[model samples]
Target: MTVPDSLADADGLATFAVATVLGFEDFGADAVVEAVRKSLPELADEYGEQVFAQLSSALRGAEGDGASPWSRRTRWPSLEDRVQRMERVEYAQLCRVRDALTLLVEASPALALARRAGVENSDVRHIEAVRALNRRTDEYLRRAEAVSRYPAERAWKGFTGLLLHVCSSPGRLSTFQQDVTVLDPALNDVPGLGRRVLARCMAASDGEA
Candidate 1:
Protein backbone atom coordinates (compact mmCIF):
# COMPACT_ATOMS: atom_id res chain seq x y z
CA MET A 1 0.00 0.00 0.00
CA THR A 2 1.16 3.51 -0.73
CA VAL A 3 1.98 5.73 2.25
CA PRO A 4 -0.54 8.49 2.70
CA ASP A 5 0.51 12.00 1.84
CA SER A 6 0.00 13.10 5.43
CA LEU A 7 2.40 10.40 6.53
CA ALA A 8 5.05 11.10 3.92
CA ASP A 9 7.33 13.22 6.11
CA ALA A 10 9.93 11.98 8.59
CA ASP A 11 7.62 11.71 11.60
CA GLY A 12 4.78 10.27 9.55
CA LEU A 13 7.06 7.80 7.87
CA ALA A 14 8.46 6.70 11.23
CA THR A 15 4.96 6.15 12.58
CA PHE A 16 4.20 4.17 9.48
CA ALA A 17 7.24 1.99 10.06
CA VAL A 18 6.16 1.33 13.65
CA ALA A 19 2.69 0.39 12.43
CA THR A 20 4.23 -1.86 9.80
CA VAL A 21 6.24 -3.76 12.41
CA LEU A 22 3.26 -4.05 14.73
CA GLY A 23 1.14 -5.17 11.80
CA PHE A 24 3.57 -7.93 10.97
CA GLU A 25 3.32 -9.13 14.54
CA ASP A 26 -0.43 -8.94 15.07
CA PHE A 27 -3.03 -7.02 13.06
CA GLY A 28 -3.12 -6.76 9.26
CA ALA A 29 -1.10 -4.04 7.57
CA ASP A 30 -4.16 -2.20 6.34
CA ALA A 31 -5.67 -2.02 9.80
CA VAL A 32 -2.44 -0.86 11.37
CA VAL A 33 -1.93 1.77 8.70
CA GLU A 34 -5.42 3.09 9.18
CA ALA A 35 -5.05 3.19 12.91
CA VAL A 36 -1.79 5.07 12.66
CA ARG A 37 -3.31 7.52 10.24
CA LYS A 38 -6.07 8.28 12.69
CA SER A 39 -3.58 8.82 15.49
CA LEU A 40 -1.01 10.67 13.39
CA PRO A 41 -1.77 14.14 14.69
CA GLU A 42 -1.60 13.13 18.33
CA LEU A 43 1.58 11.11 17.86
CA ALA A 44 3.23 13.95 16.03
CA ASP A 45 2.37 16.29 18.83
CA GLU A 46 3.69 13.91 21.46
CA TYR A 47 7.12 13.21 19.95
CA GLY A 48 9.73 15.07 17.97
CA GLU A 49 10.31 14.12 14.35
CA GLN A 50 13.97 13.31 15.01
CA VAL A 51 13.09 10.83 17.71
CA PHE A 52 10.66 9.13 15.39
CA ALA A 53 13.28 8.97 12.69
CA GLN A 54 15.74 7.30 15.04
CA LEU A 55 13.13 4.76 16.11
CA SER A 56 12.21 4.04 12.51
CA SER A 57 15.86 3.54 11.60
CA ALA A 58 16.34 1.21 14.54
CA LEU A 59 13.33 -0.83 13.50
CA ARG A 60 14.68 -1.04 9.99
CA GLY A 61 18.01 -2.37 11.19
CA ALA A 62 16.22 -4.84 13.43
CA GLU A 63 14.09 -6.27 10.63
CA GLY A 64 17.16 -6.59 8.37
CA ASP A 65 15.12 -7.81 5.42
CA GLY A 66 15.24 -4.76 3.12
CA ALA A 67 11.49 -5.02 2.70
CA SER A 68 11.32 -1.25 2.23
CA PRO A 69 13.74 1.65 2.11
CA TRP A 70 12.97 2.38 5.74
CA SER A 71 13.96 -1.14 6.78
CA ARG A 72 16.89 -1.76 4.45
CA ARG A 73 19.87 -3.11 6.36
CA THR A 74 23.19 -1.33 6.05
CA ARG A 75 26.65 -2.80 5.37
CA TRP A 76 27.58 -2.19 9.01
CA PRO A 77 28.87 -5.37 10.67
CA SER A 78 26.43 -5.09 13.57
CA LEU A 79 23.19 -3.38 14.57
CA GLU A 80 25.04 -1.55 17.33
CA ASP A 81 27.39 -0.10 14.71
CA ARG A 82 24.46 1.14 12.64
CA VAL A 83 22.76 2.65 15.69
CA GLN A 84 25.95 4.37 16.83
CA ARG A 85 26.30 5.95 13.43
CA MET A 86 22.71 7.13 13.43
CA GLU A 87 22.41 8.39 17.06
CA ARG A 88 25.02 7.51 19.58
CA VAL A 89 23.47 9.13 22.68
CA GLU A 90 20.09 7.60 22.07
CA TYR A 91 21.66 4.20 21.52
CA ALA A 92 23.63 4.46 24.75
CA GLN A 93 20.56 5.49 26.74
CA LEU A 94 18.55 2.62 25.34
CA CYS A 95 21.33 0.17 26.07
CA ARG A 96 21.38 1.28 29.69
CA VAL A 97 17.65 0.81 30.02
CA ARG A 98 17.83 -2.60 28.31
CA ASP A 99 20.56 -3.77 30.66
CA ALA A 100 18.65 -2.59 33.72
CA LEU A 101 15.52 -4.43 32.61
CA THR A 102 17.54 -7.56 31.93
CA LEU A 103 19.04 -7.47 35.39
CA LEU A 104 15.64 -6.99 37.02
CA VAL A 105 14.18 -9.88 35.06
CA GLU A 106 17.10 -12.09 36.03
CA ALA A 107 16.78 -11.28 39.71
CA SER A 108 13.00 -11.72 39.77
CA PRO A 109 12.94 -15.13 41.44
CA ALA A 110 15.17 -14.11 44.31
CA LEU A 111 13.22 -10.91 44.71
CA ALA A 112 9.98 -12.82 44.92
CA LEU A 113 11.41 -15.13 47.52
CA ALA A 114 12.57 -12.24 49.62
CA ARG A 115 9.19 -10.57 49.39
CA ARG A 116 7.48 -13.81 50.36
CA ALA A 117 9.71 -14.29 53.34
CA GLY A 118 8.65 -10.92 54.80
CA VAL A 119 12.10 -9.33 54.79
CA GLU A 120 13.35 -10.74 58.06
CA ASN A 121 16.63 -9.49 59.58
CA SER A 122 18.42 -12.43 58.00
CA ASP A 123 17.19 -11.25 54.57
CA VAL A 124 18.40 -7.69 55.08
CA ARG A 125 21.28 -8.12 52.67
CA HIS A 126 19.03 -9.57 49.98
CA ILE A 127 16.51 -6.79 50.49
CA GLU A 128 19.27 -4.22 50.25
CA ALA A 129 20.45 -5.74 47.00
CA VAL A 130 16.95 -5.66 45.57
CA ARG A 131 16.54 -2.05 46.61
CA ALA A 132 19.85 -1.16 44.97
CA LEU A 133 18.82 -2.85 41.74
CA ASN A 134 15.45 -1.14 41.84
CA ARG A 135 17.13 2.21 42.33
CA ARG A 136 19.48 1.52 39.44
CA THR A 137 16.63 0.53 37.20
CA ASP A 138 14.77 3.70 38.10
CA GLU A 139 17.83 5.80 37.41
CA TYR A 140 18.33 4.25 34.01
CA LEU A 141 14.65 4.61 33.17
CA ARG A 142 14.72 8.28 34.05
CA ARG A 143 17.78 8.76 31.90
CA ALA A 144 16.07 7.06 28.98
CA GLU A 145 12.91 9.11 29.43
CA ALA A 146 14.91 12.30 29.49
CA VAL A 147 16.39 11.40 26.11
CA SER A 148 13.25 9.93 24.52
CA ARG A 149 10.60 12.04 22.87
CA TYR A 150 8.00 9.33 22.51
CA PRO A 151 6.43 6.38 24.34
CA ALA A 152 9.63 4.97 25.81
CA GLU A 153 8.85 6.70 29.06
CA ARG A 154 5.44 5.14 29.34
CA ALA A 155 6.73 1.75 28.22
CA TRP A 156 9.48 1.68 30.81
CA LYS A 157 7.10 2.80 33.50
CA GLY A 158 4.79 -0.07 32.68
CA PHE A 159 7.68 -2.52 32.55
CA THR A 160 9.03 -1.37 35.91
CA GLY A 161 5.57 -1.49 37.39
CA LEU A 162 5.13 -5.05 36.20
CA LEU A 163 8.50 -6.01 37.60
CA LEU A 164 7.62 -4.59 40.98
CA HIS A 165 4.28 -6.35 41.00
CA VAL A 166 5.79 -9.72 40.12
CA CYS A 167 8.46 -9.41 42.74
CA SER A 168 6.00 -8.36 45.43
CA SER A 169 3.37 -10.94 44.65
CA PRO A 170 4.64 -14.47 44.29
CA GLY A 171 1.31 -15.71 42.92
CA ARG A 172 1.75 -13.49 39.85
CA LEU A 173 5.30 -14.50 39.13
CA SER A 174 4.30 -17.41 36.91
CA THR A 175 2.09 -15.23 34.72
CA PHE A 176 4.77 -12.59 34.52
CA GLN A 177 7.30 -15.21 33.49
CA GLN A 178 4.96 -16.49 30.80
CA ASP A 179 4.40 -13.02 29.40
CA VAL A 180 8.13 -12.33 29.33
CA THR A 181 8.66 -15.63 27.52
CA VAL A 182 6.17 -14.57 24.88
CA LEU A 183 8.00 -11.29 24.49
CA ASP A 184 11.43 -12.94 24.39
CA PRO A 185 11.64 -12.80 20.61
CA ALA A 186 10.96 -9.08 20.51
CA LEU A 187 13.29 -8.43 23.41
CA ASN A 188 16.05 -10.26 21.52
CA ASP A 189 15.19 -8.84 18.12
CA VAL A 190 16.08 -5.25 18.91
CA PRO A 191 18.14 -3.90 21.78
CA GLY A 192 15.57 -1.34 23.00
CA LEU A 193 13.07 -0.68 20.24
CA GLY A 194 11.35 -4.05 20.48
CA ARG A 195 11.00 -3.87 24.24
CA ARG A 196 9.69 -0.33 24.05
CA VAL A 197 7.12 -1.16 21.39
CA LEU A 198 5.90 -4.33 23.08
CA ALA A 199 5.71 -2.66 26.48
CA ARG A 200 3.84 0.35 25.13
CA CYS A 201 1.35 -1.89 23.34
CA MET A 202 0.83 -3.88 26.52
CA ALA A 203 0.39 -0.74 28.61
CA ALA A 204 -2.10 0.69 26.12
CA SER A 205 -4.12 -2.47 26.49
CA ASP A 206 -3.93 -2.20 30.31
CA GLY A 207 -2.09 -5.52 30.39
CA GLU A 208 0.06 -4.87 33.43
CA ALA A 209 1.80 -8.06 34.46
Candidate 2:
Protein backbone atom coordinates (compact mmCIF):
# COMPACT_ATOMS: atom_id res chain seq x y z
CA MET A 1 0.00 0.00 0.00
CA THR A 2 1.13 3.55 -0.69
CA VAL A 3 2.26 5.31 2.44
CA PRO A 4 -0.05 8.23 3.11
CA ASP A 5 1.31 11.75 2.86
CA SER A 6 -0.26 12.44 6.25
CA LEU A 7 2.64 10.52 7.77
CA ALA A 8 4.81 13.61 7.43
CA ASP A 9 4.41 14.50 11.10
CA ALA A 10 7.15 13.73 13.63
CA ASP A 11 5.60 10.62 15.12
CA GLY A 12 4.39 9.35 11.75
CA LEU A 13 7.77 9.99 10.18
CA ALA A 14 9.53 8.13 12.97
CA THR A 15 7.23 5.16 12.58
CA PHE A 16 7.80 5.15 8.83
CA ALA A 17 11.55 5.34 9.31
CA VAL A 18 11.55 2.37 11.67
CA ALA A 19 9.32 0.37 9.39
CA THR A 20 11.53 1.20 6.44
CA VAL A 21 14.65 0.05 8.28
CA LEU A 22 13.01 -3.09 9.63
CA GLY A 23 11.77 -3.90 6.11
CA PHE A 24 9.85 -7.08 5.42
CA GLU A 25 12.88 -9.37 5.61
CA ASP A 26 14.89 -8.14 8.58
CA PHE A 27 12.16 -8.26 11.26
CA GLY A 28 9.25 -10.52 12.09
CA ALA A 29 5.78 -10.04 10.60
CA ASP A 30 4.20 -9.85 14.06
CA ALA A 31 6.04 -6.59 14.74
CA VAL A 32 4.76 -4.98 11.54
CA VAL A 33 1.20 -6.15 12.17
CA GLU A 34 1.33 -4.84 15.69
CA ALA A 35 2.69 -1.52 14.54
CA VAL A 36 -0.01 -1.12 11.96
CA ARG A 37 -2.73 -1.87 14.49
CA LYS A 38 -1.27 0.54 17.03
CA SER A 39 -0.93 3.34 14.51
CA LEU A 40 -4.33 3.00 12.91
CA PRO A 41 -6.33 4.84 15.56
CA GLU A 42 -3.77 7.61 15.86
CA LEU A 43 -3.57 7.94 12.09
CA ALA A 44 -7.31 8.13 11.89
CA ASP A 45 -7.37 10.91 14.43
CA GLU A 46 -4.54 12.85 12.81
CA TYR A 47 -5.71 12.46 9.26
CA GLY A 48 -9.36 11.92 8.44
CA GLU A 49 -11.90 9.12 8.13
CA GLN A 50 -11.28 8.84 4.40
CA VAL A 51 -7.56 8.26 4.86
CA PHE A 52 -8.19 5.86 7.69
CA ALA A 53 -10.76 3.94 5.69
CA GLN A 54 -8.38 3.64 2.77
CA LEU A 55 -5.58 2.41 4.99
CA SER A 56 -7.83 -0.02 6.79
CA SER A 57 -9.14 -1.46 3.54
CA ALA A 58 -5.64 -1.83 2.18
CA LEU A 59 -4.47 -3.60 5.31
CA ARG A 60 -7.47 -5.90 5.34
CA GLY A 61 -6.75 -6.87 1.79
CA ALA A 62 -3.11 -7.53 2.61
CA GLU A 63 -3.74 -9.53 5.79
CA GLY A 64 -5.01 -13.10 5.90
CA ASP A 65 -6.20 -15.64 8.46
CA GLY A 66 -3.75 -14.71 11.23
CA ALA A 67 -0.99 -14.23 8.64
CA SER A 68 1.09 -11.09 8.32
CA PRO A 69 0.79 -9.04 5.16
CA TRP A 70 4.52 -9.36 4.81
CA SER A 71 4.30 -13.16 5.01
CA ARG A 72 1.83 -13.24 2.17
CA ARG A 73 4.36 -11.47 -0.03
CA THR A 74 7.17 -13.94 0.68
CA ARG A 75 7.61 -17.70 0.42
CA TRP A 76 8.09 -18.14 4.15
CA PRO A 77 4.77 -19.17 5.66
CA SER A 78 5.48 -19.15 9.39
CA LEU A 79 7.07 -16.73 11.88
CA GLU A 80 9.62 -19.39 12.89
CA ASP A 81 10.70 -19.86 9.28
CA ARG A 82 11.02 -16.11 8.77
CA VAL A 83 13.01 -15.69 11.98
CA GLN A 84 15.43 -18.46 10.94
CA ARG A 85 15.84 -16.86 7.52
CA MET A 86 16.49 -13.43 9.06
CA GLU A 87 19.09 -14.92 11.43
CA ARG A 88 20.98 -16.58 8.58
CA VAL A 89 20.92 -13.41 6.49
CA GLU A 90 22.00 -11.22 9.40
CA TYR A 91 24.82 -13.62 10.31
CA ALA A 92 26.24 -13.68 6.80
CA GLN A 93 26.02 -9.88 6.46
CA LEU A 94 27.70 -9.39 9.84
CA CYS A 95 30.53 -11.74 8.92
CA ARG A 96 31.20 -10.04 5.60
CA VAL A 97 31.20 -6.57 7.13
CA ARG A 98 33.38 -7.76 10.02
CA ASP A 99 35.94 -9.27 7.65
CA ALA A 100 36.11 -6.11 5.58
CA LEU A 101 36.44 -3.96 8.69
CA THR A 102 39.22 -6.17 10.00
CA LEU A 103 41.20 -5.50 6.86
CA LEU A 104 40.57 -1.76 7.17
CA VAL A 105 41.63 -1.81 10.83
CA GLU A 106 44.88 -3.56 9.93
CA ALA A 107 45.62 -0.83 7.38
CA SER A 108 44.62 1.99 9.71
CA PRO A 109 48.19 2.67 10.90
CA ALA A 110 49.41 3.18 7.35
CA LEU A 111 46.37 5.27 6.56
CA ALA A 112 47.19 7.44 9.55
CA LEU A 113 50.76 7.85 8.35
CA ALA A 114 49.52 8.75 4.91
CA ARG A 115 47.21 11.38 6.37
CA ARG A 116 50.17 12.88 8.26
CA ALA A 117 52.18 12.85 5.01
CA GLY A 118 49.49 14.96 3.27
CA VAL A 119 48.17 11.97 1.30
CA GLU A 120 44.41 12.20 1.26
CA ASN A 121 41.95 9.77 -0.29
CA SER A 122 38.42 8.46 -0.04
CA ASP A 123 39.63 5.44 1.91
CA VAL A 124 40.06 7.51 5.05
CA ARG A 125 36.53 8.84 4.98
CA HIS A 126 35.09 5.49 3.97
CA ILE A 127 36.94 3.75 6.77
CA GLU A 128 35.69 6.34 9.23
CA ALA A 129 32.12 5.76 8.10
CA VAL A 130 32.41 1.99 8.27
CA ARG A 131 33.98 2.26 11.69
CA ALA A 132 31.04 4.32 12.91
CA LEU A 133 28.61 1.78 11.51
CA ASN A 134 30.55 -1.05 13.15
CA ARG A 135 30.55 0.73 16.50
CA ARG A 136 26.79 1.30 16.28
CA THR A 137 26.19 -2.33 15.33
CA ASP A 138 28.27 -3.53 18.25
CA GLU A 139 26.33 -1.28 20.61
CA TYR A 140 23.03 -2.58 19.24
CA LEU A 141 24.16 -6.16 19.70
CA ARG A 142 25.09 -5.46 23.31
CA ARG A 143 21.72 -3.86 23.95
CA ALA A 144 19.97 -6.79 22.31
CA GLU A 145 21.81 -9.23 24.57
CA ALA A 146 20.88 -7.28 27.69
CA VAL A 147 17.24 -7.06 26.65
CA SER A 148 17.00 -10.76 25.87
CA ARG A 149 16.45 -11.38 29.58
CA TYR A 150 13.57 -8.90 29.75
CA PRO A 151 9.88 -9.68 29.33
CA ALA A 152 8.37 -9.53 25.83
CA GLU A 153 7.06 -5.94 26.02
CA ARG A 154 10.29 -4.57 27.41
CA ALA A 155 12.25 -6.64 24.94
CA TRP A 156 10.36 -5.09 22.04
CA LYS A 157 11.03 -1.60 23.39
CA GLY A 158 14.72 -2.42 23.55
CA PHE A 159 14.59 -3.72 19.99
CA THR A 160 12.96 -0.53 18.70
CA GLY A 161 15.44 1.58 20.63
CA LEU A 162 18.28 -0.26 18.96
CA LEU A 163 16.63 0.13 15.59
CA LEU A 164 16.30 3.88 16.07
CA HIS A 165 19.92 4.13 17.14
CA VAL A 166 21.12 2.29 14.06
CA CYS A 167 18.71 3.46 11.37
CA SER A 168 18.38 7.10 12.31
CA SER A 169 21.73 7.88 10.71
CA PRO A 170 21.48 7.68 6.94
CA GLY A 171 25.16 8.45 6.56
CA ARG A 172 26.12 5.32 8.44
CA LEU A 173 24.43 3.12 5.85
CA SER A 174 25.92 5.07 2.94
CA THR A 175 29.42 4.97 4.31
CA PHE A 176 29.20 1.22 4.90
CA GLN A 177 28.32 0.84 1.22
CA GLN A 178 31.25 3.06 0.22
CA ASP A 179 33.73 1.02 2.29
CA VAL A 180 32.47 -2.32 1.01
CA THR A 181 32.51 -1.22 -2.61
CA VAL A 182 36.01 0.30 -2.43
CA LEU A 183 37.74 -2.06 0.02
CA ASP A 184 36.04 -5.41 -0.51
CA PRO A 185 38.30 -6.05 -3.51
CA ALA A 186 41.53 -5.37 -1.60
CA LEU A 187 41.99 -9.12 -1.04
CA ASN A 188 40.22 -10.37 -4.14
CA ASP A 189 43.48 -10.70 -6.08
CA VAL A 190 44.77 -12.95 -3.34
CA PRO A 191 42.11 -15.61 -3.11
CA GLY A 192 43.86 -17.54 -0.31
CA LEU A 193 44.11 -14.46 1.92
CA GLY A 194 40.53 -13.54 1.17
CA ARG A 195 39.33 -17.01 2.09
CA ARG A 196 41.39 -17.00 5.26
CA VAL A 197 40.01 -13.66 6.41
CA LEU A 198 36.45 -14.68 5.64
CA ALA A 199 36.98 -18.03 7.39
CA ARG A 200 38.30 -16.23 10.45
CA CYS A 201 35.33 -13.92 10.49
CA MET A 202 32.89 -16.83 10.18
CA ALA A 203 34.65 -18.73 12.94
CA ALA A 204 34.63 -15.71 15.21
CA SER A 205 30.96 -15.18 14.58
CA ASP A 206 30.24 -18.81 15.40
CA GLY A 207 32.22 -18.42 18.68
CA GLU A 208 34.69 -21.00 17.45
CA ALA A 209 37.60 -18.56 17.18
The lowest-lDDT stretch of 10 consecutive residues in candidate 2 is 40-49
Where is model 2 more than 4 Å wrong at Cα?
1-89, 119-175, 183-209
For model 1, the superposed segments whose C-alpha errors exceed 4 Å read 1-88, 119-126, 129-209
lDDT tens readout by residue for model 1, 64-170 = 44354334422222545433433533445345444545644444433334444443332334334444544323332333333342366775675655334334333
Query: Positional deviation of 195 in candidate 2, in angstroms?
Result: 23
TM-score for each predicted model, relative to the true structure = 0.22, 0.24
lDDT string for model 2 (1-209, tens) is: 33342343334445645866555334334444445544443333223345444443444545444334443332312556434434544555555554544443344344444444443344444444544555433333334445554677886676555443322333443344453554444334433443444554555558743
Error of 1 at 202 (Å): 35
- Residue pairs in steric clash, candidate 2? none
